[model samples]
Target: MTLYLCLPLLAVLLQPALCLNCSSQFERTPDNSDLIVDCGTSVITLQINLCTAHWAGFNSSDLALNGNHNNSKCKGSIDTSVDPPVIHYQLPVNDSQDNPCRQSLQIVDEAPDPSGPFSAFSSIQSVIITGYIDTPRSDQGVISYSTDLYYHFSCRYPLEYLINNTEIVASSVSVATSENNGTFIDTLMMRVFNGSDYGYGLSVPPTGLELRTRIYVEVKAVNLTGNFNVLLDHCFGTPSPYNMSQSEQHNFFTGCSTDQRTTVTSNGLSKVARFDFEAFRFVQHRDQAKSSIYLHCILRLCEPTKCQELLSACNSRRKRSLTPFGEESNESATVSVGPLYTAREDTPSAAAYSNNMAPESAEDDVTGLVVGVVFGTAAAVALVLGGWFALKKYYRV
Candidate 1:
């Protein structure tokens, strides 16, 4: 075939590999300007600033949102009035039939564990945006050229809004059970703290908590939308995790605290509802036995617009009801955390206990523990007696 004919065929075969030569990553100028991605309520905006010194021929057509070559929802333009140029893009946040360009949303949640940091967060929702750039097509024979590699970049954002509420709850915790029988809520977590931070004081097994110590707790709404904030309606603590071994103490009733320390950080003003109380042992706790403390909360997500008024009027003598998430029905869900043992007087301090204890040994039975202690004592006594006998025999008086 003629050289001209071959060139045409080669270009057709390499059509899939158009090289946009986009930067390897976000490029920052000496003055500090770089790629900026802004997430908004209904639309997302992205701006890419490139210095003419390094990117002389860069244009707005080199990058595609989600790699959609024919996407109608995304639009872009290039600005060259200044020494460097800026490429701008705007796309809808939501995906629909009219505009097929789609962004992804993800929800992350895990069951709370005994670990200090792990037990505190129950759930989180995040939105992720992605895009890809075109690069040079590979060719050989008579033609030779260098090319940049294709790249896909992503950015993540939490689906939460800015709230102005920052009240600290002052209520203390006591033994209690669930007053409402509603089903359990998903993605809500309960976190415990002994002092300023999450003290390693909460034990596995064979360990115990210091009695009468203050405990701070935070409860967060995970799967709910960003428009709603969690509010504590009622809460109680007990020695048992699920069953009622004894009468429980009341922390909050109808959004009002029974004690000053037993505060609900806000009256449905924030997504994370916080409160605190002191740790105590069961009056009838047995000796040398494994034990735990469980906390139960009856709460719901409420819109900020209606939460303050609804919770404030709780002090009035009129009949009161709560409609969680601005719904007509009185919907609420229960969240609980437990198997938390108070540190025994003989146990290590909270920080050491958290770092040293094995989670598996917590389930060991008391009988097994007692047997091990006895065996160790017997071995020590036998060693002492044997040493005395050997010394007396060696003297041979």
Candidate 2:
């Protein structure tokens, strides 16, 4: 039985023009031939009947795809009891940083046109697997009719479609604004902690603070793919959910921080960025009640090269930047977290309700989100200039 994959994949099966010396006499037996590629979390379970022409009898020793030398590596079993008998090759191929089988990755980036299979995506990532089937020949003639059957196949699994697959998991609260570019989400998780090492997270965020209590904020960008990192372009705090340009606003990055104590301790170093500033309460309006402020940040995704360039250009981040962020490039996405309470109440009444920074409330704005995926890593992310090569699948002739 062929193992079918639950996740949808765009698979391309290609074959050579000649089926070795047997091409003249035999044809592929579709009914008896089975090619199953089971892409598991870590391994790709491949089950393909040995490549042989119709009614051809082949021995295990004569077969060589990955190799016939070691059964522990590339093994096979014969189903001779069946009507015509078939050689089943079941190989567990590993696709990881240590790519032993030499599988490759190719990123296809182009404008969406109304014509082809690629029309749906402006950017797509494809994993390609290639191999050849070898069968020995007897009498070598004048033309040397010896040849092996070569084959190669690829699957298109866009990062967007990666949602249901176990390959990538999102472990944070995220808000995404996109259409056909589903799952190309950008997540920026933030929290206000205390101390120099970003130590001790607040039991309740934006918890009540005294007038001179300097605040420590940490923002992390996660789940980005390819050759890119994230950068904090502009960050500021507003007294209310809305960006009130005039009054109760404090700049953390724009090369301007009212509090000179403010500093971007880390940036472009890793995934997390840290900064601190003396906490201050908004001027209580004559009709106002309690004091609250919100944090807003604009994040940009860039390749390591550009990220380094932007890191130097981000004049205000003297405070902090990626402590980590990546490459191609994309526009920016703005995300925020807060409603931090700065009002000092000895016996605070509303402090208990400040825990709304949960995932459920992450919908309204970036107010409650603490974790999520990174933007620009998906959608028409328009990036990653990998080596372009014309991979030729050849059968030894």
RMSD of each: 23.1, 32.4
Error of 2 at 367 (Å): 60
Clashes of each: 22, 33
lDDT of 1 at 305: 53
- Supply candidate 1's per-residue lDDT for 278: 64
Off by over 4 Å in 2: 1-187, 203-207, 222-228, 242-248, 255-261, 284-289, 314-337, 344-397
lDDT of 1 by residue, 177-210 (tens): 1212111244455666555454543333345555
Off by over 4 Å in 1: 1-186, 196-206, 222-224, 243-254, 284-291, 315-336, 343-397
Q: Give the range of the ten consecutive residues with the poorest summed lDDT in model 1.
A: 161-170
Q: For each candidate, what TM-score against the reference?
A: 0.37, 0.41
Residue 304 local lDDT, model 2: 65
State the C-alpha lDDT per candidate: 0.48, 0.45
